[model samples]
Target: MNQIKKWISENIVVLFFCMLCIAAYTIAGQNPYVVASDLINRVMRNSIMVLALIIPILTGMGLNFGIVVGAMSAQAALIFVTHWRLTGVAGIAAALVMCTAVSVLCGYLLGRLFNRTRGQEMITGMIAGYFGQGIYLLIFLVLLGTVIPFWDDQLSISTGIGVKDTLNLQEGMKGALDAAYKLPLSTVCIIGFAIFTVYTGYRLWKAGDEEQKAGRRGRIVRWAGLGILLAALLVIPVTSAVIRRCSIPVITLIFILLVSLLCQFVMNTKLGQDFRSVGNDIHIAESAGINVNRIRIIATIFSTVLASWGQFAFLQNMGTFSTYTAQQNVGTFSIAALLVGGASIDRANVKQAFIGVVLFQLLFLLAPAAGTKIFNDSQVGEYFRTIISNGVIAVALVLHAMHKAQENAKAAAEAEV
Candidate 1:
């Protein structure tokens, strides 16, 4: 009973959101296939940005709202590529290269700022994001053709002194990654199950005798689940309308999967261990001879670079870029999505990030329909989404503060004893 209560306490936020999602889905009464399709697209577009928050959180840097700078980096690169009339994969590749370089520099500066404001990294990050946006605007809006000496009628203002408000990527730049390859949704599902089955079997085989025995039932259940899922995939009709209509963006998903894998792999490495050490206790980490500030900086840099790439993918998928406001909500939305997945200020993971993206995006998709159904006004849903996004972050911060206070109190009691 105590364990159950603890579990609930730990995951109450996730449980509440899950129930809320179900209610929204029921109220919306949308077609499952349409919902699934929309969810998949959103997941692909935003998952990387959400994942980028994990490392910084793990390093005790909180949600890294400074990632908006990274998004700005991506937009800058995209602007350059678009002006150069680059197209397709080559354009994306070039933009990524430029984005990486720019984000690294921005991240380093932001990291320094974070070090100066250690315990206040979250607020500092938010401020840094605003500062970066100001600089971004000044460059593109004021310095483009003047100090920068850039000239493109389509991209530049009438006076040729600055970039335009919107940049169309309908050329070959749009869907550059997503359109590279496609597979039926059913095929993707089958492949996913097959991979899971093999991975599960491999884990079982690799476990030692005692360990294997301890987890024997759990392993068997996992294998059974995989088998059932695979069998269903095989038996499901390929001629089904949904299966035929819905397709997966193979390359885009591969990129998302690779980022997910990278997140998992990094957390198991030495640097990742340092991140944990520093995050858990900076003073202890410094005493242990770990450069806590450096680790935090690296975490910030990693997150920034990933955010840049994520923003790049996001814009490409949309096939358009809003010059001034494209990156405005990157920080708020990504952090909120992460929090919605039940991650705290100091602890997050790839699974939580992905789950959060799916749920958050699902809610966003359903909000309008659900609102229209409930209040006969779709605009209410938009307002509801705005509230939920901002509210989730606010709520998570309060919960984190309470949790930290409880821990500190318990520690104080122990020391008194």
Candidate 2:
């Protein structure tokens, strides 16, 4: 009973949002299949971006509002990709590669800046995103044709001075990465193989066998082998899902699962231990000989790179880009999604990312319909969603502060005793 109470106290904000989602779903009276299907797709699409926020939070850096920088980096890559007229997986791959490079560079810089403003990382990130957007607009609007020099007439304005306001992926990039293959049977085989690899790894480690005797080096090699195998399995399914056109985003779900598993796996590594240590107490970690600044930088880099990929994944599916504005809300929504999942200022995970996406998106899908029913105004639903999403984030922050305050009070009382 005490445990249940503690859990409730910890997750009150999530529970409240969950209730709102359920209420909205009930009131909307939408088809269950459609709603469920939409929710699943949304989760698959948005979860990665949210997952990207988890690592930085785990490192005690708070939610990475600078993920917008990563999103912008992706959009910049896609523009050149569309200009180059690269099609199919090649185009998407090119974009991913480009975004990865850009994000890594940007993440490294941002991480360095963050190290200076340590305690204010979140607010600093938010500011950096806004500042970055200004630079993005300047680059795409003014610098691209003149300074950057690209050859894609299709991607530029009539005067061929700047990039287009919208880039349609349907022509070249839509479903490019997604439509790489069609092997449902192969997908299942890969999943089974991945499961087996995991099981085998667990058993071998448990047995303290020859592999364990080799220690971290052997474990690293084993993990590398397992990761490669699992990645191969992911390819079979994700590529196949596009071809099969399953009701659910089967391949996308697999992608999310892979990412989630990767997130968990990373947390168990030495780096993850360092992150936990830094998160717990940076001063202590520093005294313990951990490179606090370096770890924080690495965390930001990972978050930015992952966020870039996540944004690209989303854009490919949507088949269009608003260019200038697409990245603006990326950070906000991703952070909100993480907060909605019951993640706090100090801790988060893939589970929170998934749950937040589901609950938050459910309310999003249902709000307009429910609003139309209740107020005979669909716009009411729009306002409701906007207000609620932002509201939930505010509430979660307050709850986090309160929880921290309570903890401090309890510690002080214990000290007095």
Candidate 3:
């Protein structure tokens, strides 16, 4: 009972959204294949950006809205690569290298800005995003052809004064990553299961006798569940058909997997523990000889770099770049998705990031259909999406404030005792 209540309290947002998804799915009446395909595509596009927010949250910096700057860095790289006529894998490799360079510089400077702002990191990040956008506009809009001396017939304006508002990436740059490789979804699932089974077995093998005994029941239940899932994946014809119909973007999915694993791996390292310490209480962490500001800066740098890579993946998958507008909402949507996954302002993880992306994207996919079904207009769904993305953030902030207040009051009472 107590445990159940605690679980409910922690996961209330996730549960609420899950219920909403079910309701929307029922109303939408969409085919499973279409939904699954769209959801997978969206997951591949947005998961890395969502994951980018984790390090900052762990190190006590809020959502790092400055990720827009990183996205901008990627766009700049993409533009240069396209201009250079680099094609296929080589183009992607060049763009990534360029993106990383820019992201590192931007991240380092942004981290310094964050260190100065301290408690106001979130708002500072938002301002930094706007500030960076201004600089981006100045360079791309004003200086590109005038001061920078760059001109391409396809990429530039009619007068060659600036880049075009929309840049077509048909020059072997589009789908460069996503189209590189593909794998059957069923095979992906089998591989996933195999990896998990090995990991579980390794954990059991490494456990002490007492620890193993204590967790035997839980381990048995988990193994049973995995066995059933694997069996269904192999034996159930309907499940097998659905899985077979889906094709995973092998290269893109591999990047997402690497990022997910990196996030988990980082959290277990000594630096990651320092991040947690700083997040929990900076004063205490400082007293313990931790460099709180340095930790925060490192966290910001990691987030910004990841966001750059994420935006690179996003544009490659989409096959076009909107130039000025593509990066504007990167931070907002990513933050909202994280919040919807049951992460608080100060706490987040890889699992929450994955769960958030799936749920958030599902709702996004369903909203228009459900709206059309009930209201005879798809626009209502767009409005609902806007509300959901912003509203979730507002609600989470309020809840976090309330939680903090309660904690403070409890501490006060203990002090009195």
Off by over 4 Å in 2: 170-172, 177-246, 409-417
Query: Would you list the clashing residue pairs of candidate 3?
Result: none
- Report the CA-based lDDT of candidate 2 relative to the real structure: 0.82
For this target, which candidate reaches the highest TM-score against the unseen true structure?
3
Tens-place lDDT digits, model 3, residues 1-417: 989986776677788889989999999999887888889899999999999999999998878899999999999999998898898878888998999899989999999999888899999999999999999999998899998999899899898888999977865877777888899888888888788778778877777889687886687689779879878876888667777898889989989999999999999999999999999999999999998878888888899899999999899889887888999889999998898788877889999999989998998889888888898877876687787778768876776676668668879999999
lDDT of 1 by residue, 70-148 (tens): 9999999999998889997689889999999999999999999999998999899999899999999999999888888
Better of 2 and 3 by TM-score: 3
In model 2, the clashing pairs are none
> Candidate 2 lDDT, tens digit per residue, 37-126?
577557767888988999899999988899999999999898888777788768867998999999999999999999999999999999
CA lDDT of each candidate? 0.88, 0.82, 0.88
Name the weakest run of 10 consecutive residues (lDDT summed) in model 1. Answer: 233-242
